[model samples]
Target: MVGNPDEPHCVSHLHPETAMDQIIPFDPERMIWGSAPALIYLEIAVRVGVIWIWTIVLLRWVGGRSISQMSVVEFLLVIALGSAVGDPMFQADVPLLYGMLTILLVVLADKAVDHAFRYWTTAKRLVDGRPTEILREGHLSHAGLDKKGIGPTEVMEMLRRAGVRNLGQVEYAYMEPSGTVSTFLYDQPRPGLTIVPPLELRRLPAPDALSGACCTSCGLVRATADGTCAECGATEVTRAERLESREISSA
Candidate 1:
């Protein structure tokens, strides 16, 4: 068959038994040191060093938020940069110049998107998503939690980490775009569902029967319960725990 003189023979044209040998061509020395000359290894090191320094400079320009509190755009930038910076380090076919250009283009796109997010409210909401209200007025927002794909247990864990003793201590709680929970506590907290003692424990201290009960699922306080939560339709109800004065003073 006539073929380009410069092009190698196609594997399909080779003998069936030899095709596998040609495809794999396993060599221990080639595997250890690669096919390139030893000098090429030094070139690879230089390319990697230059790219590493350039990446550091670009990251500095990108700001601390890109590294620490990455949004969707920033996350995309990281993945793109990883691919761009990694390929040219050892792949002889990929030029260092190409990798640098790719990195620059990715960073530029990220910056452009960031600028658009700042100027356009709709674009910002669509890309990064708006902060969701997880809790309001000592009660969990089931709709907000569902929208954010977070459960009550996760919200309670976040609150507990923030040193909250009970849902009553929180005036408002929001799930930020960075996936962090921000809590605003009341100066004088009302009695609500307790979050202490850990939920895993099957037993809890006896609650005062005369006091009002709170929905264990949603932390909604009611004068009395008829064995079901009105807010979330959960059957579990527990005594509303008040924030002690000492805890407020310590806080």
Candidate 2:
């Protein structure tokens, strides 16, 4: 019997005996081209193009900070947009209209959050944590590092990238809400622990050769006679290295 061209075909109805074998039949045409008409490809492209442009406009409205220095809220917005924009691109079942609505709602929610952050200090603090002091007067703040779950070595690496050769070069350093480190330098840098060669590679001064010492753990400077760091109580100390005038000139 002839079947209607518009109606879906069922292998089970045609051949009940061979239905089990046809359950997952290999059809290359169906797999590659899908069951939709060829024109659907053009529709998908149009949907993608429109959505891409709309997303760009919405992101621009949200401001560049969303991409550059993302806070927790901005990070979540990125994740939501990724899922919203991707599925409708290829899935024939997902309508472009629904995807567009989803994106609109997501961006609106982000804007609402920004509005709340602008007016409410408590909301801003809760979502994006306040900046924590990592260094004060060239000394590492162990308490602050512990609060932020960062180590002294990691803080030193950040300072090094910011053009700081030693702890004394930094008057203060803060770990911002965006996870970036900000360093403030002193007018005349004092003698402190060197971080260029890294702690592991640098050799410690012998007991007889020691003139001045700095804590190996937190980079706090100590008197030559002092056997322990007053700031961190670390007994292991290395020779304090001074930041040269030539280094300042080069910087």
Enumerate residue pairs that collide in model 2. none
Query: Cα lDDT of model 2 overall?
Result: 0.73
- For each candidate, C-alpha RMSD in Å? 10.4, 10.7
Model 2 scores worst on lDDT over the 10 consecutive residues at 59-68
Inter-residue clash pairs, candidate 1: none
Off by over 4 Å in 1: 1-68, 205-207
Candidate 1 C-alpha lDDT tens digits along 1-251: 68998998678865566433453333544423455565765564566456544654565444333343676566656766788889767755444555665677667667776788788989777666678898999999998887777689988988888888889999999987767789999988999988885666656444466768888888998877666776678977778889899976675
Error of 2 at 227 (Å): 4.8
The runs of at least 3 residues in candidate 2 whose Cα sits more than 4 Å from the true structure, single-residue gaps closed, are 1-68, 206-211, 224-228
